[model samples]
Target: MDRIRIGLVGIGKIARDQHLPALNQGGDFDLAATASRNGRVDGVEAHETVDALIAARPDIAAISLCTPPAGRFEQAMAAIAAGRHVMLEKPPAATVSEAEALAEAARAKGVTLFATWHSREAAEVDAARGWLADKAIRAVRIMWREDIRQWHPGQDWILAPGGFGVFDPGINALSIATRILPDPLVVLSAELAIPENRACPIAATIAMRCGTAPVAVDFDFLQTGDQTWDIEVDTDAGTLYLRNGGSRLELPGAEPMQGPNAEYPRLYARFAELIRNGESDVDLRPLRLVADAFLTGQPTPAPAFEF
Candidate 1:
């Protein structure tokens, strides 16, 4: 099959770090063009807007959007309307309604739409899922904390109302959790700690319930040491731990499981498959959980944060 000609919409940190590397490794796609206000990938035709890129690069078959959620809906719709497949970064859109609209539009246009969840592709996630398939889950806990300054320096969109704040990384944990858990879950209670000077929360404590199993998720941006991205589950058989964001899995009387670091590469491969198969992969479960937390969760004022 001929390689797909691809364009990148947002060339921010994630696009540069994860998406570009993944696309290069996939080898099924050619980086035909890119559109960004301030960032650009080497050797690719650059445009300041998606519209211009689409208008100029008629050979492009798909576009990957890596922008913030605030303005993603329009860009995605435009791309789909122009007869191109779209791969959206996590938190598909600012609101569920917008994401639904994008899905519907993609259906009408007969193009593939992928809501990419890189964490779900982590090395140990599939192994952990296989182990937990038969175990009776009693409870689940997720502790994800990191310093914003170190991870997201100078990224103002994260602090904006639609930016999702700590839920940015928090959504990653949710993605892995929803993928591994055996039962459907919903948010029961939540407390968001918003920094006094920002519109979004810097920390959040969420309580979720799935059938009889209770789950607790803690996301914070104030950690100083040993950043944690770990999920633990207590089952009737034994305790299961997925540390390092599903990169490492541990169980009683079992050696740790590890795999190749090719999340982006794998994602692009899946995208190619979906495009060839004429199907769409749009899982809103993870983003739905985050929106529910924002809508139904309680709010707590936190100390001012400066980065």
Candidate 2:
């Protein structure tokens, strides 16, 4: 099959670090253009806005959006209207309604819409899911903590109302958990630590349930030293550990299974497959869990933070 000419929106760190590399890895996509305010790719056609890119490149049949979730709904809508398949970054939109609207619009336009959870593509994620499919889950714990200065740097949008703050990364854990756990998660309680000067939470402790199993999540954006992105699940058989953002998995009485970071590459592969099959993959379970946390969470004031 011919390569799908694709344009990338948002040339930020994620685009440069992940999307660009995956697109250049000689897969089913051709990097045709990019749209960003200040960032640009080395030889690709660049535009300052998605509208301009859409108008200028009619040959681009797909748009992969890595932009912040705040205003992504309009961009996705425009692309879907133009008959281009759209791939959205995790936490697809600022609100569940926006994400749902995009999905409905894409379906009406008969275009593929992929709301990608890149963490679900981590090396051992699928294996972990397969292994847990039949196990009786007893309990689960998710610890996703990292320094915002080290990862997001001075990106103040994270503290903005729609940026999702800690949930931006916390949702990755939820994505993996939702994928591997057999039952659906229901957020029972959440304690959110909001910076005195910010609109979003800097840390959150969420208590949830998956069937009879209790799930606990600890999310923080101010960790300094060694970062932690780990999930531990206790089952009737034994314990399962997915560490390093799901790239490494450790099972009871067995050696760890680890693999290189291929999340973005695998995500692109799935997008290509969906486009070819005339289907859309817009799993909103993880996002819904985040939304539930926000809805039921009790806010507490924390010290003001700065990067």
* Per-model CA lDDT versus the true structure: 0.91, 0.95
Cα displacement (angstroms), candidate 2, residue 229, comes to 0.5
Candidate 1 clashing pairs, residues 3+ apart or interchain: none
Reference-based TM-score of each model: 0.98, 0.99
lDDT of 2 by residue, 54-117 (tens): 9999999999999999989889999999999999998899999999999999999999999999
Tens digit of lDDT per residue, candidate 1, span 1-307?
A: 9999999999998898899888877578999999999997778899999999999998999999999999999999999999999999988898888989999999999999999898999999998898899999999999999988888888988988899999999999999988999998799889999988999999999999866999999999888778999999999989999998889999988888877777888789999999999999999998899988988889999888888
Tell how far residue 226 is off in model 1, in angstroms. 1.9
Off by over 4 Å in 1: none
Candidate maximizing lDDT? 2
Root-mean-square deviation (CA) per prediction: 0.9, 0.7
Q: Which pairs of residues clash in candidate 2, taking residues 3 or more apart in a chain or in different chains?
A: none
RMSD of model 2 against the true structure: 0.7
Off by over 4 Å in 2: none
